[model samples]
Target: MRYRRFGKTEMLLSVFSLGAMRYLESAANAEKTIWHALEVGINHIETAQGYGKSEEFIGQAMRNGLSKQRDRFYLTTKIGPTKDADSMRRQIEQSLKKMNVDYVDNFDIHGINLYEHLDLVKDPNGCMKAVREAIDQKMLGHVGFSTHGSLEVILDTIRTGLFESVNLHYYYFNQRNAPAVQLAHEKDMGVFIISPSDKGGMLYNPSEELSGVCYPYTALYMCDRFLLSDPRVHTLSLGAANPSEVDSHQDAWDNDAPMSELEAAVLDCMNRRYTLLENDRCSQCYQCLPCPEGINIPEVLRLRNLAIGFDMVEFGKYRYKMFENAGHWFPGNKAIRCTDCGDCLPRCPENLEIPRLLRDTHDRLHGEEGRRLWE
Candidate 1:
């Protein structure tokens, strides 16, 4: 497996890291997957307190024997928006309890999306102070933040130069955060790409149109290669469902076979197809947020494109359910609760017709009975 310097740290992590989001439902399954990952040389395992049961499962799995391999891996977790410094400290203590670890290799402030959040962290009594105190106490080896926001927030966070690492959404399908990744590299901070495959549901079977455009390379391998091809990406965290998923990725890593001329041609064709798909129209800036309804606008658009491009009916159905079920989690304004305000159009980075796309998603998925299983 190819290894890269994990930011300014001396540790060299595998190009592919294991993400524990999908392991919330089953401990046995999670353990098997984690074991398989370790067996395959994936030394970086990422989890978050926001993801239910993931930390606890990792702790249990390690206690069952995986702990012996602890030194072989790099462990990371995150702290969410704590109400106050006392609460933040308590949460960190709880996280340690759940993970059964005295200290984590890396700890980050979860979801630093808005500019104001920076102020909150830098506040004397805010979570950032708590994080610093934790590090001073040797409770954390390194400190960082994760974001799903605009370039402005990303650049601002990087400029602080306070973090040893930064985790952000980045993938071949969504190069919106590429600049952030580059900035992280320039600042000598570890750059972690979260859920690259699952972003916009890119790794699933491609739509017919997308398949027609990206034929021989198979959407999965193409997506993996696209991310791995970039040297700036220190690691691509994959939410593998089973041992087989790990094995499939292992194939990509182990293969000594060079990209054939045909493969290169296919990739070029896919890139061109993506270019035409967006038409340079939507920058995916996501400024018109807080949809009155819980719609995850960017995510919906991405899944819709995946549905149309790949022609995967089941995948489309799944995406629809995710939106409908998780609808309540987002602020009412940021979701399907949107009013017919054309106000968001001007603020958009890509200048997309936001209302129109929102309407399209509702009409297409809401009518399908199979898609409403979440309801």
Candidate 2:
């Protein structure tokens, strides 16, 4: 496993940190996965209060001989934003007790997905105050946050200078957060890429076209290498469900050689796929934004791009339904909201039939509504 200096925290964290969210529905599997991760050199384990039963399962593992390896790993947990310091303080204590740990290496204010959430944490008597008190009491090491907010909101949060790290979405399929990652790096804040596999266009079950494009390297390995190639990125969270699942996260190469010739070829192929005019791709330019109806045109079209260009209909439906259901964590109405306003039509460099494509996207990808995993 390769390790990186996790920004200003000064901890050398494995590039493949274990995410304790999925496949942790039971204590036994949780213990098995945790042990396997530690044996395989993953030194960081991150969980959150909203990730049902995860903390309890971790505590159970610790009590079942895993505690003997305490010093061998770093523990991190998160609490949702609360309006008051007392509530935040209670959640912190609960997390510590549930995890069977005296101190968490990192404690994040989870899901600062809206401007109001940022305000809540920054309030003098709100969550950050309690987090600071925890640090002073020696129960928390570094403060951070996870987000699914807009680029504007993310940039605002990073400028606060209150966090030592950030966990957010950034991967090969979606580069919207690239600027935020760069900003975090500039501020010397640890950049933890959240859900790189699943939220990253469900690469675990990649479409045959995408898999072929990443040939010689599987989509999962290619995505991992793509993110790790950036010196600014500290780690990619792997939500492994079982011991066997951990093996897939192993690096394709042992050294820090960014973008080897083979990897570059794959990237070139992916770029060609993304830009194929025959696919009616959206190009992901921001010109179609500020929708009067609050629709996120680029995101909707990006999902459409995946569906049409790479046979990723399942991934499209999965994300499309997240519209309106996930709050600011995934703020946007479905493409069905497009009123055929000619505003975005003239601006699109691709001259994509904005309203028509949006309606088509909705028709193709709309399905059973998706609830945010933590919700």
Candidate 3:
């Protein structure tokens, strides 16, 4: 496995870190997975209070001989984005007792996805105060946060300089967080990217077309290489529910692979797929923005591309639903809000019938209808 300097906290984190979000049936299963990961060189494990039973399962594994390997790993668990110190303290204590650890190397402010959540942690009387108190007591080593917030909010939180690391999402389809990852590097903060396989376009079960496009390398391996190729990305959270599945992740650990050639192949196929000029696709250029009705036209068109070109109906619906009332996070209006406005038409280089395409974008991915491939 390849390791990278995990910024201010100064640990050499593995490029592929194990995440405990997908703990399987039994404690023994979790124990086996943990042991297998350690044997394979993945030394960082991240878990959270919100992930049901994941903490308890890890504790169970530690109790069953796995504790002997404790020093071989760097442990991190998250707690409250709570409004007060007491709640944070209570959660921290529970995490420690549950994990049966003397101290966690990193304690996270779980999910600070908005300005108010950041406020809860930074309020002096809030979560961070308790976290600092714990650090002083030697029960915690470093403090950080994980977020699913907007780009502006993420950058604002990183700029606070209070964190040793920051965990967020950044992958192929979701390059929206690229700027924040770069900012974290500048701030000397560790960048741990969460759910790269599942959220990075559900790559484990790539479609035939996708498989062909990424020939000589599987889709998941392509994604793993893409994320690891960037210096800003310290590690990717690969969550496995079964011990046998861990081998798939192990296969993705080659740092010396010929990734540039593979990337060119994937991009060559991607460009062809996305450049369609029928009722099926849009160029995804943001030049037609500032829709008079306040709609995210380019974004809608991009999602529209999935349903028509890639036949990724479930993912299209899943993401399309994120726009329902997402406000400025997605910004502008839904496709249904367009009023046949010709304003965007003049700006569009593709000469797409703006209103018609907007309606098509909405109609195709519009309902709660879909067959989810897998989680």
Candidate 2 error regions (>4 Å):
253-255, 346-349
> lDDT of each structure?
0.72, 0.88, 0.79
lDDT for position 72 in model 1? 91
Q: How much does each candidate deviate from the true structure in C-alpha RMSD?
A: 4.2, 1.6, 3.9
Count of clashing pairs, candidate 3: 3
Candidate that would win on TM-score: 2
Error of 3 at 219 (Å): 1.0
How do these models rank on TM-score, best leading?
2, 3, 1
| Model 2, residue 123: C-alpha shift (Å) | 1.5
**Where does candidate 1 stray beyond 4 Å?**
200-202, 208-212, 255-261, 274-358, 367-375
User: Per-candidate TM vs. native?
Assistant: 0.82, 0.96, 0.85
Candidate 2 residue 284 Cα shift, in angstroms, is 2.2
Candidate 3 positional error at 101, Å? 1.5
Instruction: Please give, for residues 1-375, the per-residue lDDT of candidate 1 as tens digits.
Output: 878888786569888889887766688999999988888889988888888789999989878988888799988898765647888899999998998888888888887777667777767787777888988999888888887666778889889887888888876666777788888989888888887666534565556676677676667777677667667767888788777778666646653245668767878886555454463234456676645454567665664554444454455555555544343222122234557677776778776777777666565554333321112
Q: State which candidate, 1 or 2, has the greater lDDT.
A: 2
> Best to worst by lDDT, what's the order?
2, 3, 1
Clashing pairs in 2: none
Question: Model 3: residues >4 Å from true position, as ranges?
Answer: 256-258, 277-301, 318-359, 366-375
